[model samples]
Target: MKAQVLIRPKAGILDPQGIAVEQALPALGFGGVSNVRVGRLVELDVEDPEQLDAMCQKLLANPLIEDYEVLTSS
Candidate 1:
């Protein structure tokens, strides 16, 4: 099994990285790209995305402001 973890800044928080990426998207040949939010993609060799989500809320991410989703594939 594998897990993909997306660690991003919480809403209403300052994300300079995301902002920079959003501004550079058009210059990088990406058309109509707006509101780009940069995040981290962590692919883990594991069992469940749900379990990972729980782990994220518990340890990986801050549930107070951050939003996250889980998807599992076999």
Candidate 2:
């Protein structure tokens, strides 16, 4: 099975990368883009789909300031 993990900072958490991008967008000719948040995508092949969540919680995400979602594909 193929698994994808999407990891992102939790809401209300200060995101410096997101802030920097949001501030730079207007100067780069991109407008009206707000609430910009940066995240990570991890794609891998897993023998057990059931272990995906555990992977996210244990290592893939902080679980304190970050949240993760798992998607499995056949």
Candidate 3:
């Protein structure tokens, strides 16, 4: 089955990519933007659905500074 792991910074964490995007918005004519939080899309195939949560907890995110969500059969 397919799974997607989305890792994002925890609240109160500094997001450099998000900051960069926010600064660039005006240059790209998206002046209405204020804040941006950057994240990623990681797609993978897993043999066991039950392992999905464990996978994220063990390796997908840094528990101290990041948060993650897993999408199953994606």
Candidate 4:
């Protein structure tokens, strides 16, 4: 099975990269953009999908400052 992990900073956390992108959008002709949050995606091939959450909690995402979601590709 193919697994996908989406990791992102938790709410109320400061995101400098997101802020930079948001600030540059208007100059690039894109407007009305707000609350931009940056995140990362990880793809893996695994035999068991159930273990993905543990992987996220242990290695993929920082439990104190980030959140993650695991998805399986059918």
Candidate 5:
């Protein structure tokens, strides 16, 4: 099976990169863009579905600063 993980900064956490992007948007002529948050997408092949959470908890994401969602594709 193929598993995909979407990891992003938790609410109330300062996102410097996101802030920078949001600030630069208007200069680049991209308007009406608000609340631009940056995240990561990790795709991998897994033998067991249950191991996905463990992988995220251990290495894929930092639970304290970020939140993650797991998606499976066949």
Candidate 6:
């Protein structure tokens, strides 16, 4: 199976990278863009699809300050 994990900072958490991108957008001639956020995507092949959640909770993301979503495909 092929799996992808999308990891991002949780709401109400301070996101410096997001802020920087948001600010830069306006100056670069892109207007009306707001609430910019930065996230990461991790793709992998796994034998057991059931273990995807465990991998996310244990090492792929920091549950305290981050949120994650897992996607799987055959």
- Kindly list the per-residue Cα lDDT of model 4 for residues 1-74, writing each as its tens digit: 99889999999999998999999999999999999999999999999888888899899999899989888986
lDDT of 6 by residue, 1-74 (tens): 99999999999898999999999999999999988989899999999999999999999999999999999999
lDDT of 5 by residue, 29-62 (tens): 9999989899999999998999999999999999
TM-score of each prediction? 0.66, 0.96, 0.89, 0.95, 0.94, 0.96
Candidate 2 per-residue C-alpha lDDT over 1-74 given as tens digits, one digit per residue, 9 for 90 to 100:
99899999999998999999999999999999999999999999999898888889889999999989998899
Cα misplacement distance, residue 21 of candidate 2 (Å): 0.7
Task: Candidate 4: list runs displaced more than 4 Å.
Answer: none
Question: lDDT per model, in order?
Answer: 0.73, 0.94, 0.86, 0.93, 0.95, 0.95
Q: Comparing 4 and 5 by TM-score, which wins?
A: 4
The reply for model 1, stretches above 4 Å from the true place, is 28-31, 47-50
Task: Note each model's CA RMSD in angstroms.
Answer: 2.6, 0.6, 1.3, 0.7, 0.7, 0.6
60, model 2: CA deviation in Å?
Answer: 0.5
Ranking by lDDT: 5, 6, 2, 4, 3, 1
- Give one digit per residue, the lDDT tens place, for model 1 in 1-74: 76666777788887788889888888889888767787766667775445786688797677776666655556
List pairs with backbone clashes in candidate 6. Answer: none
Point out where model 5 deviates above 4 Å: none
Residue pairs clashing, model 4: none
Candidate 6 at 63: error in angstroms? 0.4
In model 2, which regions exceed 4 Å deviation? none
Which is the winner by lDDT between candidate 4 and candidate 6?
6
